[model samples]
Target: MTQNLGGILLIRMTSLGDIILTLPAIRAIRQHFPLHRVTMLTSLEYIDLVSEIPYLDEIITLDRRGKEPAETIRVVRQLRQKKFDLVIDLHGKFRTRLLSGLSGGRQRIGSRRDIYPPNTHAIDDHFQLLSTIGIQANDKSLEFYVTEANQCFAQELLNEKLLLGDQVKVGIFPGARWDYKCWPADRFAEVADRIGKQYNAAILLFGGPAEADLVSQVRDSMQADPILFDTNLQIGQLAALISFCDQFVSNDTGPTHIAVALGIPTIVLFGATNHLKFGPLDPMHTVIRHGNSLDRSKGNDMMRLITTDEVWKIAEGKLNSLDK
Candidate 1:
C-alpha cells in the first residue's frame, strides 16, 4: 500500500555500535523517499554522531539514564509535535513500544522474535522491524558517509605526525561496553605488536575515557611501538580515522560497525553475545569467536567462550590479506 508520504520517525535508542549499524536502513529510507522528512530518536550522547550523518532531517535525543515516565512522556509530546506519518520502532523496547503506540503515527513498525533461528544476527533481526511495513529485505550493505572535511582533518593529523603518504594505518578497538565482547588487553597488545612488526603498520588504539586504563595497559604490554588514541575522540574524528585505516581490529563495539560501514576491512572479536545476531554484515569484515571469558565479574555473560589465539589468527589473516 502506497501510504501518503509525510514525515518519518525512527526509534533506535541503542548504543553507538547499534546506531552505527542502522545507517543502512536510514540510507534506504532516505533514498526510497527523497522528499520525506526523516527523523531519528536516539541517545542524547550520540547526537553528534547522528548529526554528521546526512540523511536525518531531525534527531530527538532520549537520555536513557534516569529513564523516568515523565521523560518518556516529554519525548512523546515532542514526537506528537513532529506529526510523523510513520514510526519505525527499531529499538522495540517497552519505551519505544509505548512512544510509537501513543505518538499517533499511522504506521508503527517493529520486530518479530521468531523470524530467524535464535542468535541469527542482529542486522537480520533489526531488518525484521521493516517487515511490519511490507518492506522486503535484501542484501543491502551497511552505510557510512565520511565528509571531506573530516577526511581533511584526519589527514592533517596524520600529516602533522609525518605519517601520511603510502603508510598503512590500522585501528584497534580494545573497548566494548560488555566484558564478554572485549579481548584481553594483553592479547590485543600481543597481536598488535606482531602485526605492526610484520606489516610496518601503525596501530592506533581507539576507546573512550572509561577505557583509558585498558588502553594504557595494552600500550604498556605492546612490544612494537603504537599510537594510543585512547582518549575520547569525537564521532567524526573516529569515523575519519577509521576511513583512513587500512584495516581495523576491534571487539564487538560501535567502532567495528563504523569500520565496516566505512568499507574498511575489520576483524571483530565476539564472545558471550550471540554472534549470529550481532556479527558484522560486511564481506570486508570477519568475526572471530572464542570461549566465553565473559563472567559476572567482567560485566558480561558467563556462558560464552573464546580464546586469544583464535582471534590472533583471524586478525593476522585479515590484516595480511587487506587490499592496498
Candidate 2:
C-alpha cells in the first residue's frame, strides 16, 4: 500500500477518559507517518490536555456547546479547507462520523465494531480502526505529557498548602460524571483516613468545579484534613498535580485514566460498568469491581457493594509495593 504524503486529520471530541484512551493509537499513527502532517480535532475544553500530547503536528478544537449544529457546520467547513488525504474518526458517534464524511478527505476511516467486538478494551478498539488502513499498532500503552509550567504550578499549589514534601502523597478523586459511577463519599473518606493514618500520607482530593460539593462532602467526612483541589484546573495542570502523587484512588472516572497514563499506581473502583472493557489494563494498576456480574439496573447499589475494606486492602498493597 502506498502511503499518502498529504495531511491526516484525526477526530475525537468530548469526554476526558475516551480522549486519553486514544493516545496509543495516535502515537502509532505518528510513528507510521512521520513526515505526514498529523492533526487532531478535539473539543475546545480539552485543548490544554491535547496540547500536552507530543504525537500530532497540529490540533483543531470545536466548541459544540450551545449551538452544536452551527458549530459543526463551521468545523466541517474548516476541515474541508485543510484538504486532508486521510481522516480517521476515533470517536464513532453520529457527529464525528458526519464530520469525517464531509471533511473532504480522500480517504476516511471510522470505527470497525465488526473487526473488534464491543467487549474489547477501548485501547484495542482504537487499534482495530487503524488495522483497516494496514497500520499495525504494537505499543498499546497510554501516554499523558506534563509540561514544565504545569509542574511548577502544581508544586507552587502544594507549597502554598504545606503539602510539598517526601511524605507519601495519595490522590483521591471521589466524584464521577454519574452518581452511579461514583463510590459513596463517606466510603471514600473512610479509605482516605485509613491510608493517611496507616502510611502517614498526605491526602489530596481532586475534582472539577461541578464536583466541588461532592469533594467537600468527602473532605468533611474524613477524620484528617485533606488538601482540596476543586479549583477548575485545566486538564494538563491536573495531570501535573496527579504526577506528584505516589498512589491514586478514584471511582470509574476520567482522572483514573489520567493516573494510569502517567504510570502512577492506581486503584479504581468499578460498578455498573464492565471492568474488563473500561478498566486499566496496566499491571501497575488495580481495579476493584463491585461484583462478578454487571447490573446497571441496580444503579449505585452496585457501587455500594464494594466495601471500604475491599478497596483499602488493594490500596495498602499498592502503597506497600511503592514503599519497597
Candidate 3:
C-alpha cells in the first residue's frame, strides 16, 4: 500500500446501526492519515447522517433499487473519475467489489468474502479493514453530534407534550424491525408501570411512524399515561429526545444505537439475533438476553423467555443509583 495520503474513499451502505458502528473505524482511518481527503460512499438516506463528522471530507450517494448494471457501470465510471489514492470496501458485496476494483486506486483493501467468517462484532470486523492501513482501533467509542437545531426542535415537541423540567424520564422503544426481535408490548407496559411507580417517572415512548401501532399498544396497556412523541421527528431530533431521558430501554433496533451513542443509560433486550455482535458498546449500558437454552439463531422464542421482573430489576438498579 502506498503512503501517498492523497484522496481516499470508504464504502459502506447499510442500516443505521451498522453505519453508526462504522464510525470508530473511520475515526481511526482519519487519525492514521490526518491530511488525506476522506470521502464516504453511502445510500442517499444516510448522505446527511455524516454531515457533522469532522473526519469525513465528502459524501457521495448511489441510489439504486435491485439489479441495474447500466447504472452500476455509470457509477463505476463516476468513482474512477474521483482518482482515489486508496479505496476500502467495508461492505463486501458484489457491487462494492466491482466499484473498488474499477476505482483505479493504487491501493485497495477489502475483506475476502471467502475467508471471512460470519456474525463477528461489526466494530471488530471494521478494525480488520483498518489493519491494512496500519491502524488499530484501541478506542472503540461510537460518535454523534446533537446540533442546536435538533435541541430546539425536540424542546418545542417536549413543550407541546408538557415534558419539561428536571423530571425523571424513562424512555422505551418497544419495536424492532422484525417482529421476532421485539419483546411483547404488554410486557414493556408492565415494566413501565413498575418503574413509573418507583420513581413517579414520565415514561417516554419512541419509534418511527411504522411502529406507532406498537407504541400505542404499549401505552394502552399501561395504567399510567406514558408520553408519546409524534412519529415524524427526524433522526437527529429523536436523538435529542433520547438524550433527555434519565434512562432508556429498547428492543435491538437502529434508534437504540442512536441512544447508546448519546451516552444514555440504555437497556437493550435481545431475543432472536445474537447480541454478541450487536449489543451496547458502552460498558455502563445494560443488555438483558434471555437466559434459557434455546438456540438463539433459530427463532423468536427468546423474547418470551425474559420475564418483565428481570428487566424491572435492572431498570430499578439504574434508577435507584441515580437517586444517590
Per residue, candidate 3 scores C-alpha lDDT tens digits across 1-324 of 445668999988777787898888889889888888999888766665677677899987777776477767777788888899888888888868878898887789985646545556778888887876787777789888888998888788888888757779999999887788888999999999999898888899887879888889998999999998888677787888888889999888988898888888989998867677778777779998865343545436788778898999999989988853
- List ranges where model 2 is wrong by over 4 Å: 112-115, 292-295
Whole-model Cα lDDT per candidate?
0.77, 0.88, 0.83
Per-model TM-score, in order, reads: 0.88, 0.96, 0.92
**Candidate 1, 113-227: lDDT as tens digits:** 5555686666666656665565656656777777788789888887776775777788988888766567778878987887788788888888876889889889999987787
Expressed as tens digits, the lDDT of each residue in 13-65 for candidate 2 is 97899899899999999889888999999999889888878888899899967
Against the true structure, candidate 3 reaches a TM-score of: 0.92
Instruction: Report the candidate with higher lDDT, 2 versus 3.
Output: 2
| Candidate 2, residue 152: lDDT | 99
Error of 3 at 74 (Å): 4.4
CA RMSD per model (angstroms): 2.9, 1.5, 2.4
- Residue 17 CA error for candidate 3 (Å)? 0.4
Backbone clash pairs in model 3 (N, Cα, C under 3 Å; residues 3+ apart or in different chains), count:
0
